[model samples]
Target chain A: MRFIDDFRNAEHVKALAGSIERRAAQAGRPLRFMEVCGGHTMAIHRFGLPQLLPESVELLSGPGCPVCVTPTTYIDRAIELGRDGALLTTFGDLYRVPGSERSVEGASAAGLLEALVVYSPRDALRAAQDSHDREVVFLAIGFETTAPTVAATLLEAKRLGLRNFRVLSGHKTMPRALRALLEAPEVAIDGFILPGHVCTITGARPFTFIPDEFGVPCCVTGFEPADILASIEKLTELCGPGRRPALENAYRRAVRPDGNEKALALLERVMVPVDAQWRGIGHIPGSGLDLGPQWLEFRVEPPDPERPSAEYSACRCGDVLRGLIKPAECSLFGEVCTPDSPVGPCMVSSEGSCAAHFKYGSQTFTAGLAEIAENGKGY
Target chain B: MTEKTIKLGHGSGGSLTRALIEETLLRYFDSPLLAGLPDSAKVQLQGVPAAFTTDTYVVDPLFFPGGDIGKLAVYGTVNDLAVVGAIPRFISCALIIEEGLPQSDLRTILSSMRQAADHAGTEVVTGDTKVVPRGKADSIFINTAGIGAFRPESALPDAEMKAGDVVLVSGPIGDHGAAVLSAREGLNLDSAILSDCAPVTEVAQAILAGARRTSFLRDVTRGGLVTILNEAVGGAPLGLLLREQDIPVRPGVRSICELLGLDPFYLACEGRVAAVIDAESAPIVVEAVRRTPAGQDATIIGEATAEYAGEIVIETAFGTHRLVQMLSGEQLPRIC
Candidate 1:
């Protein structure tokens, strides 16, 4: 708890909150800050940072959750492989997430799929090694933080000559996705709290375009309460009237400006950037990473053309992901779409905006709204 | 409708398990006694009120850092009976052993079970054993059913929880879960973590003695504390408000949870007991619980609230509040 306890210190948090308030007051106008990582979304809600921030500073949840951004088609295809007599493995979060028609759980319940939750790609390899008769397909879905491990796993599989293993890669690159969001006309993001873990891999250089091109301040911050608050403070000062937009690294301890060279090299050797389809957001060019040609045989095939595509017409996940609307604004938010029976990935993924709002933000917001109605202020 | 096959989540003892009980199992066996869904079934047997509870243990690896499946099987049933304010007296064990299991391993398991029963002061008077083919079952599976005499003078009803009641948890959460997970996954952490698997009978007795009214007592087992609270307030005109900072979680367990991307609140604890007591008597009950061996880490974690009825709200250390939902599906380790 060396790093963790220090970040959650009550005295430090209070002092930071006071400084953030002062910075927000100096800005005068309302400021919108978006943290583009599922980890950040969860941390912000877990620490209840929104209530501590000034009313003029609004935090918007962007498409940061890898599981939330993964398209339903990917889940559908993974389930299809499981039904076709292949052993499927994925991180636990994907087990209950709904595809167009069925989830991995639903498919397993129907006795058509044999799926297991593995903590890492190595575990998936071990499962394949343990079962010689069945082919094991690992559903690889994550950002840069996890893709390097998957790359290493692929390399090891090749070195070990393990032909029974394959990967269904849904791995995405965060920089391009962030670029897409910044370019979106509907999104009114004032500044960005860049993903700290991803920045640790690809480094702060990838995010320079955000400030230089779009004139939006960006801060690479850790997931701790203090890191988030300090990043918000930096963004507030940078967003001041006369200050030039800049990219600052508030999470300097973990993230270097150049990032991990070995991880970047490993990604370069095993994978290439491709046009990837995000679940709610449409396809962004060169946003997804696919296994290199040497690993193509290990790639799970696409879904059959005859299978009907499923869509949640009632869900506003796309709007929510684009920061066009808050999760509560969605019509199916808490009523029909809940954590138990999620109508959208936003409600299903722990990092998704809807899940964070439903679990932490909504009730707190309601309580704050009630207090404001009575006393004219939330805090 | 086509019958849906069982999934692992149905056995996770979380929201899915509750749904299975209420939606499928309870539908077939509808009765007032079954409707209560207490940890143990309360029944009058030959003019004597008794608490009867049964539990099955299918833990992997058979043995863990602090205890094995045998001890878990024994203490699990005894604790279930004890939480109902009963004096656990008799236990019946029925084990399903696989054919290829080693004889020496069987002896070790049985010996551990005997020691655990002795420690809890309960008698395993009757037992049954069956051997299945190698592929049919795991190495071994244990089923224990316990019976305890319920004294009317000290009866603690499960449905007696009211608004403003105090919630107390005996000892830290997630020790058993983290220990088992680490042992299974081979996580060689810097510190050694052990399972908190023991009978909570003494803690329960002390709590009942000190509290003016003990509303309910639940062993935080497979679904951990949050699930138990959710079940405790199901459909009731009350909610639970917990302070995140007050909840006791060991540093090692916290580190493991952080590394694995899991929540300690949803992790399992075999020995801990979550109790609801009258607000005024919380201090006395906490003191009483502290005197017991199992309740050395006892503290008031939260209180029953009228706001957000049937929901559990946690006031985070950062001065924000969030809802603690029941564990849905398995507590799978997150990738990111």
Candidate 2:
């Protein structure tokens, strides 16, 4: 608790909160800041940061949850691989995610497929090594923070000449998605709180475009109460009238301007950028990662296009992810799309904004009900 | 449409498990005792109040740091009975052994069970065993059923729980979960954490003997403290407000949870007990609990509240609050 307890100091958080309130008052307008990372989303809600910030300072969620953004087609492909007698492996976030037809968890539970949840890509590689007679396909999905590990695992597989190991990549880059969000007609985010973990790999340099081109102040943020509050304070200070938009690094403790070079090099050697489809958001060109030519032998085939995919037109995840509305504002947020029977990936993935809202921020919606019940009109 | 089959989450002791019980199992077994679904069933035998509980251990590796499956089986059942205000006196063990299991491993497990039973002051009055083919079972699976006489002076009824009641935890949590996970061969890190798989009988007994009014008591096990607390306020028009800083968690467990993107609140603990007592007697109960060896870390974690009914809200260090929902499924590691 050395580093953790220190960052969560109440005194520091209170000071930062007071500073943010002062800065927002000086700005003389309602400030809308978007935190473009699932970790930030969870941390903000987990610590109930909104209660600390002034009502004028509204925080919006962006397309930062990797599992939420992963296209259902990718999951369909993994299920196909499992159905073809291959052992499917993936992160637990993707286990219950409803694909086009059925999720990997559903397929496995029905005895139609064999699947396992691996904490890391190397665990999937180990499964491949352990099961020599069968093919092991890792349902690779994540952002840059997780891609390097998958890249390293592929390199290791190549070094050992493991033939049965395969990967279906759904990895995506973050900075480009931010660019798309800014360019969207409906989104009016005044500033951005960058993802700390992804920035640790890609560094703060990739996100400079948000401020330099879009004139929105951005800060690379950490996932602590004080860290987030400090970032908010910094972004608010920079957003003052007559102040030029700039990028800041409040998470310098773990991130660098240049990022982890070794990981960048790993991505360069074994992976390449490609056009990929985001689940709620539509296609974003050159926003995805795939195995490079040298590692193509380890790649799994694309999903079958003919597979019947369920349409979730009623899900307002796209609007929620785009910062146009809060999760509670979505009609199907609680009663219709609870975590147990999620109507969209946003409700299924733990880091998704809806899941975070439902789990940690539902007091806003339920407080009224509780008040009514306390008035003696029993629920 | 998703197929209806027994998924792994059904055994996770979370929402899916509750659904399986309410939607399926309860349909066949409709008795009120089973319907209430307390850790142990309360009944009267020969006009004497008693508690009965059973648990099965299928923890992989069979053995882990600081404890093994055998000890877990005995302690798990005894703690269930103990928390229900009963004096654990008799337990029965049943084993389903894989054919290829080594004799030494079996001996080690059985001997640990015997030692655990003796330490808890309970007797294995009757038992059964069966050998299955190699693939039929894991290395070994142990099931234990216990019986205990109700302590008339310390009968903490569920209906007695109300707003303003204080909640106290016996010790740090998540050690058992972290230790078992570390014992597996993956995510490559050498951990020194040990499973807190000892008996919570002392802690439970201490609280009961000290508290002027004890309303509810539960052994924090499979679903951890959050799940237990959620169950405490499930149907009641009450909520719990927990101080995040007050919850005791070991540094090692916290580090492991951080690395894996897991919440320590949802992690399992085998040797901890959470009790809901009258607000006036909380300090006295904490003092009494600290007198026990296993309860040295005891502290008041939270208190029931009339606001935010049917929810558990945790107040953070920054004076902000959030709702702590019952875990929908297993606490899986997140992908960054």
- For every candidate, what share of the true interface contacts is present? 0.69, 0.86
A1-379, model 1: which lDDT tens digit per residue? 9889999988899889999899888888999999889999998887788878888998988889999988888898898888888999989888888887878988888888889889999999999999886899999999999999999999899998898999998899999998998888888999999999999999999999999999999999999999999999999999776899999999999999999999999999999887788888877888888888778878876443233335588889988888888887787887898787799989998778888887764545555646635743221
Cα lDDT tens digits, model 1, B1-336, are: 346767787888887788889888888998787677888888889888898999999998799989999999999999999998888989999999999999999899999999999999899999999999998999999999999987666747444787889999999999999999999999999998899999999899888878987887889999898988887788877889999999999999999999999899988999999998999989998998999999999999999987756778888776677778787778877878
TM-score for candidate 2: 0.96
| Worst 10 contiguous positions by lDDT, candidate 1 chain A | A302-311
Q: Which residue pairs in model 2 clash with each other?
A: none
- Which lDDT tens digits does candidate 2 get at residues A1-379? 5798788899989999999999999988999999988899999999888888887898999999999988788887888889999999889989999987888999998898999898889989999999997999998888999999999999999999999999998888998898889898889998999999999999999998888899899999899899999999998999888889999999999999999999999999999888878877878888888888888899986653233234488889988899998887777888789888898878889999999988885446334445545653211
Q: In DockQ, how does model 1 score against the reference complex?
A: 0.64
lDDT of 2 at B286: 93
TM-score of 1: 0.95
Clashing pairs in 1: none
